[model samples]
Target: MSGGVDSAVAAARAVEAGHEVVGVHLALSRAGGTLRTGSRGCCTIEDAMDARRVADRLGIPFYVWDFSERFRDDVIEDFVSEYRAGRTPNPCMRCNERIKFAALLERALELGFDAVCTGHYAILRDGENGLELHRSSEEAKDQSYVLGVLTADQLAHCLFPLGETPSKALVRAEAEARGLAVASKPDSYDICFIPDGDTRGWLAEKVGTAPGEIVDRSGAVVGSHDGAHAFTVGQRKGLRLGVPAPDGKPRFVLEVRPVSNTVVVGPREALAIAELAGARFTWAGTAPDAPHEEFACDVQVRAHADPVPAVAVVRDGELVIRPDEPLHGVAPGQTAVVYAGTRVLGQCTIDRTVSAVPAAV
Candidate 1:
């Protein structure tokens, strides 16, 4: 339940629906700490206790499953590897893909459970093609972007009780009405492992600092940074570049070249991306049947970001998306979620990009 109001309300709704539900709280961290350092992260011991209390209130069996080892191997290591490869990854997506849906769901099904229920704010509906994933009624809290990596089989055995909840405030109100203590628990914002939200500091400890040069488009060294892994595409702040552009305008990080140990900075215009190519594509329901080579769709690159109008095609085992308008700061390792209206088609892990700017003539 994550010891949050949303999940508590979801459990209540499930109970009210007359389904036999059991609460399972995953212990994601191996550390023996009970206190949360900040108001972020979901694996604190206090969170487990809160979840247990809710399960007690609901009069359902509760169990804390130790998934720490798998989580580290799958989510944590993948985060480090992606950064080392100079790609910006969304670890939350990885957690949802590898740990929650794949690992936990498999175990649940083996234990004779029909479906795995969670507090995610997305809807599962029976579409013409069978099962389909859709955005939550609460637009601001929509999490379909992260859950887009789920395949059709995974969606078939999943449930989201709060998908139709009007808003987060209503969820909290429902928890209060049910006398759940977690109704006022603050939502987690930072990455679960990096509770303090010091991503650069945490990465530096793991990836180590390899001093590198920060260069501009002309290959002129503009500044230096502790490591290329510390920066991301389209980043403007923290460059520590004392020199300004020739026109006295600011510059942004256009790329992170880990092999060269270089952070490429340039005019913001250089960050514009025309196309993205991704591997490891997965469809939520059925694959789209395009009469032609390409079809129109909406592509979302980041969580809670607006989906852009685009043309998509599958080529040689990869998904390619061409935005009708140029996008900026699209990084490798980020997910490209495809959608038709509000229905989530599928997602791909971006591996390459095509810049909008033409090469020097």
Candidate 2:
């Protein structure tokens, strides 16, 4: 259990299902707590203690595994590097794919456990032949986006106990009835390592002071920013630009050119995107065997963001996605997840926006 309400209820469900369950909190960190003390993050010792308490209340065994070093090297460091490369990174997905399900699951299976169970809001079913990944009854809290990277073999070896319950209400009732301490804890949605959701501050801390320029589409120097690391694609407010468009309207950030230390600010219409090129795609429920089959799906470029209709063509290992309805503000280094209804088909890391939407939209 991750020392949270959902996981607590998940544990209760497992116990009700008559399955022996053990709760383990992963100890992963780098600079310090993954989030502020009260915020949602696994790095805090308090979260570990919370997981232990859940184990105690549930009458199950609990242990804390120290994987801090590995987490830093694999997740945090990679997050920093991806931002530096002008790409947004999904550290949570990385943690799930690397530490939790990959490393910890393997260790658990090696220790003779039948499977490693999690509180993820996705269904696992006994299909015609084996376990299948399905949409959770709880659509709002469906975390199938991050878990989409798992392989079929991995799904066969895993268990998700809270798949059928809608998260915000049903999960709460389950936890409250059980009298668990974390029954009402609010869910965390920001980056774990960056408290206050300030990724620019974290990048500044790691990359030192690298100055950059802010210019318009015509390459006119409009403003000078502190550092290119402090900006991202589609950003607007902090551009510190004193310039206005011909219509006397405010401008927004259009690009972050790290190589030349430039932050481009322009009209909001410049942010629309129609196509995107991504690499390192991993499909979950099913893998599209060919390019024609792959591109025939809708995709999401960010979490909690709407999934626009799209098609994918997997060239070699890279999947290039073209959205049917123009998607605005497509950013590099962000994840583009594809889905069909509630089922997660696959996802890829964004490389660049090739076809963008019309500015008016």
Candidate 3:
């Protein structure tokens, strides 16, 4: 349980299904006194206490497993290294892939547990081929994009009871009916480790900032910044450029080149991406029968963004995708989740992109 309404309700459903269920709360941070600041952070000491209460009410075993060291080495360090390399990474994806599923699930099976169930809003169905991962009935709460890293073996031992639920309001109501204390608790949002949600400030402390030049498409210096790591693709509000665009239009961050300590700004249209490919890829259940042949699929670049029609293929040991329409503001280190209708196909860490607009010669 996560000390939230969704997880509490999931635990209740699992118990009602007549299976021996145990509530396990992961302690991702070593700071035992860390507490949630409103709904901004999660998995704190307070959340553990709330989870224990729910387990007690359900008359099941509860334990707080310390995965802090592994989390720091995998998720936190990876976040810093990616930013240092001028890439924007999804920490939640890494947490789910490395810490939650890999580390936690491994321990659960060793302890004679059948599966590691959670409150994630996704579905698992027994397809003709094997186990298939699909989106949840609740469109607004669908989280299959983040779970695309799970392999065939992992999905076989997983259970998500809330996949068919129509809405989150119904989950909250069920929790209240069960007398769970966290029925009305606010859902956690931003990154868990960064409680204040100031990623730039936190990154600055880890990777010391240095003054850098901001340039345009034609190699013309436009402005200066304290650090190139502080900016991301498509950001436009805080440029503070000394020179304005020739047409009096606003310029957006197009790229961050950490090697030269430079930030590139340009017209918004330059952000359109024509093609993307990555070597680091994984399939959700099974690899395509003809991996080298092009296949139709929908690609999602962000967690909540709508998927776009695309053609994908595995070539030269990398997964390459070309969207029907140009993708805007996509950056390296971001995950591209491929899907066939509601079923998740796989995902890749975008290593590079080809801009739709040609550079000025």
Candidate 4:
């Protein structure tokens, strides 16, 4: 349980189903005093206590597993390194891939658990091929994009009770009916470790600031930044450009070149991405029969972003995707989840992007 309404209700349903259920709250951070400010963050001391209360009400075992060290090494460090490499990573994806499903699920199976159930809004159906991951019944609460990293083996041992639920309101009502204390708890948002929601400030402390040039597409120096790591693709504010654009239009961050220590800025149109590819990729259940052949699919770059019609192919040991419509604000290190309708095909950590617009002279 996450000390949230969804998980509490999920636990309740699991218990009602007559299965022995254990609620395990992961202590992802070693900080004991970590507290949720409104709904800004999660996995804190208060969240654990709330989870325990829910477990107590359900009359099931509850344990707070300390996964802080592993989380720091995997998710936190990976976030820092990706930022240093000038790529915008989704830490939630990493946590789900490495910590939640990998580390937690591994330990759960060893302890004789049949499955690791959670409150994630995603569906798992027994398809013709095998078990397949799909989007939730409620489109608004769908989270299959983040769970795309789960392999066939992992998906087999997972259960998501809230996947078929019509709405979050129902989950909250169910929790309240069950007398769970977290029924009215607000949902957590943003990165859990960075409770304050100041990502730039948090990254600055980890990646020390360095003077770097901000250049336009034509190789003209437009501004300077404290650190190239602080900026991301499509960011429009805080450039502090000494020289304004010739057309006086606002310039956006087009790229962050860590090797050159340069922040590339240009017009908003330059943010359109024609192509993106990554070497590191995984299938949700089973690999496509023709892995090297081009396939029609929809590519979702961000968690809440709309999926775009695309053609994907595996060539030269990389998953190359070309969206029919150009994608804006796409950056390396961001995960691109491929979907065929509601079914999650797989995902890849974007290693590179090709701009749709030509460079300005």
Each prediction's whole-model lDDT (CA): 0.90, 0.75, 0.93, 0.93
Error of 4 at 209 (Å): 0.8
lDDT by residue for model 3 (239-309), tens: 99999999899899999999999999999999999999999999999777787999999999999999999
Candidate 2 lDDT by residue in tens digits, 205-286? 9976676778887888887877887777777676677666667777777677778878877776777777787777776745
Residue 14 in candidate 2, Cα distance off native in Å: 1.5
Q: State the local distance difference test value for candidate 3.
A: 0.93
Output the lDDT of residue 150, model 3: 90
CA error at residue 249 for candidate 4, angstroms = 1.1
Candidate 1 Cα RMSD (Å): 1.3
**How many clashes (backbone N, Cα, C below 3 Å) per candidate?**
0, 11, 0, 0
lDDT winner between candidates 1 and 4: 4
- Model 3 / residue 350 / CA error / Å: 0.7
lDDT of 4: 0.93
Model 4 misses residue 181 by how many Å? Answer: 1.4
Query: Each model's TM-score, in the order given?
Result: 0.98, 0.92, 0.98, 0.99
lDDT digits (tens) for residues 133-222 of candidate 4: 999998888999999999999999999999999999988888888888888898999999998999999999999999989998888897
